[model samples]
Target: MTTSQNPTAQAPYKQLRRPTTDRMIAGVASGLGRYFDADPTLVRVIFAVVTVLTGGLAALTYPVIWFLMPEEPPTAPPWPTAATTAAPAAATTTPAPTMPVHGDRGPI
Candidate 1:
């Protein structure tokens, strides 16, 4: 039976994205773990074994995936956004303090 016809059918998994935290290198293992519903430690152990057994070919391939794989966007922190962020008007009102040109001697 087709999935659409079945009322119990679940939606397909989302595209893989590297997580922002709980990662040793690029979060590839953790991302894979989340996708497959597996333990990340197991994945990391497997990767390490494969890399060693294959004379580090997997090591080189890891960076390739890191470069290609999209990282997950950072989640908003639970903080007072208004107090942390400066308003555009307030920024314009206060000019940044000028530094003395040519060291601390104020203008040589």
Candidate 2:
């Protein structure tokens, strides 16, 4: 059935997912570019300009967006890839102990 014929039919909304590819900092611009149908470079340039014009407000907001926007889910590795299969030794190994932090130092 044609989309025009169905009143319930609607265009798919673009999700703001942080892509793993074409990322400089946190894939924010790349994901935004894909969602808004703009070039990643253009998005970056616009962000840079906004940051400068807004007295670093954009810079501060970027991190907020990075934290809010979820990273794109990892895709399954291709077949026959080394990462796809675990070695026998690796499977039998135990996790290493984490180093303890001292109060004298800054936040751990």
Candidate 3:
């Protein structure tokens, strides 16, 4: 199956960044979610727990990511074409088999 393109696909990976829209606090979790190909909510929950356990030291790291991570441009979906839509039907059709000649016999 074809995979969707992400910011990493288009640009070089460096440090992680916060996502602009998906973020709950500072978008740090959303940025990590994009990098790791995971759900944003999961990352947020983990970070929240870490912050609580660390007595807010984990929370302090967020601003550093917020400043270091590059902003990702919004991606546009690929436009559907008639050929793309019809590809599945074409792929399902069977090809005709050729009969083997006596002298040219090989594995069927």
TM-score of each: 0.55, 0.57, 0.53
| Predictions in order: lDDT | 0.73, 0.76, 0.70
Tens-place lDDT digits, model 3, residues 5-87: 66535334443655556668677777787678677889888988999999999988888877887765556222224556676
Stretches of candidate 2 exceeding 4 Å from the true structure: 1-12, 76-108
TM-score: the better of candidates 1 and 3: 1
Model 1, 1-108: lDDT tens per residue? 655454333336455767887688889988777667677899899999999999998898888888888887665222223446666785579777988776577555
Lowest lDDT 10-mer window, candidate 1? Answer: 75-84
Which numbered prediction scores highest in TM-score against the true structure? Answer: 2
Q: What would the per-residue lDDT of candidate 2 be over residues 1-108, giving only the tens digit for each residue? A: 655454333336556778886699999998788778788899999999999999998899889889999887556121122445667886799999977676656567
Candidate 2 lands at a TM-score of 0.57
lDDT leader:
2
Query: In model 1, where do residues sit more than 4 Å from their true spots?
Result: 1-12, 76-108
For model 2, what is the C-alpha lDDT against the true structure? Answer: 0.76
Error of 3 at 2 (Å): 32
